[model samples]
Target: MYRLVLLVLLALPLAGCFAPRAEDTARNWRPMGANGLALGRLVALSPGVTRATWEAFAGIKGQTVVRLAAEYDPVRAAAGCPPPEAGMVRAARSFLIVDLAVTPQKSVDFIAAKAQAYSADGYFEEYDLDIGVIAALAARARPMPCADLALPGYLR
Candidate 1:
């Protein structure tokens, strides 16, 4: 399995939302536990910096990997995505609680380690994603490196 620097997201198709719901706004994202949710493939290649970013955003004290998986079934994602879209990744639709994070690189390492769960031979389930979206998020995000998170599970 392979890790991606960026992925897709989905919302009300933009355009003013047509008929917005109270829950649609980011203001009302209720907290949900991380238990029993379908775990997505963790592509941890660069855990160090990714964990740093997550810690900063999550306002936590320790290094943390912030997984952003969709509430819907990952299979429901486009049958084949090339560059993935913000609309394709549904953050507002769900929440990704911390799975585990011991050090800075712990997150990316987990992502890379979990590749098999979501990919085969190196192709990702979101491989059908569009390049534009992936490129944009890559440009926008402060991605950590694969090496930072490459330790074996025993190390943790």
Candidate 2:
């Protein structure tokens, strides 16, 4: 039971990351590490992909996730980021698979919000290089406070 509760707590933040607004599609400019705080990175789509695949890839970091988000790293993107020397790659792949399976298909706004969140800190700018591929799964259909999801009367 403790593990289950812990898992849910961990999931809440990830869950919050998937909220969306209606006008999100119109605003395409992605936010990247604004105001400073090395956290995440985003690689936008030259050709956008499906929601399922996109959700599977968002907010990538930490010991277990096993993925990297390098919006600034050109060489790494081209390299296809070969797995590390020992077992890190396997561990990352396993965690990613689990994340993909668990996250549901969310709105485009959710995806955009995630992009913004990366910018909220310094996540996007931190990554050294990530260009060319748009992303492996660099977005989450996340919600924003300024977006439609929040009610003006209650929120403000």
Candidate 3:
């Protein structure tokens, strides 16, 4: 019985190795409780003004907001813009509260054309979005980290 107990203890550590690594799991991670809808990966497709308006709309719709930013060193780096900064890195402690919605390709195309015609620096952020769209996206937003929000059992 003692030998059996010792073997069980030894096997317990090995059991962990069979489980997926955190990074591996994160790669496949989808926001929990999003039903069939999913938030697209955030990209730097537009400028700051657009981001601000989108954030305002997102607030009204109660979507999960991840204010993300990055720093870029145009020339040889200085003290503030240190090394290992070849590309964008998440900006220091900045976040914009914003609504997120998926725009239909048709709408996106139309807006792009209009911007080109008018020679606008960029288009209004929420030009293609509405409250209903924001709500839909919000419904699928992953629960904010470390906050309990009456989530579904699976998510909890």
Q: Mind giving the per-residue lDDT tens digits that candidate 2 earns over 1-156?
A: 999999988897786654542122212223332342211223233112112222223342311111222122222222333433332121100111111111223212122212211222222211111221223333332111112111112211
Taking all chains together, each candidate's TM-score versus the true structure is 0.17, 0.18, 0.18
Candidate order by decreasing TM-score: 3, 2, 1
Runs off by more than 4 Å, candidate 1: 1-56, 73-102, 105-156
Task: Please write out the lDDT profile of model 1 over residues 1-156, one tens digit for every residue.
Answer: 123322212333543345433212111122222332122212122111122112212324544434333222223222232333322322111112222322332222122111111222232222212223222222432122112112222211
State the local distance difference test value for candidate 3: 0.25
Model 3 stretches with alpha carbons more than 4 Å out = 1-14, 32-156
Candidate 1, residue 131: CA error in Å? 33
**Candidate 2 regions off by >4 Å?**
1-26, 30-79, 91-156
Instruction: For candidate 2, give the lDDT of residue 88.
Output: 18
Best by TM-score: 3
Candidate 1: residue 125 Cα off by (Å): 27
C-alpha lDDT (0 to 100) for residue 2 of candidate 3: 100
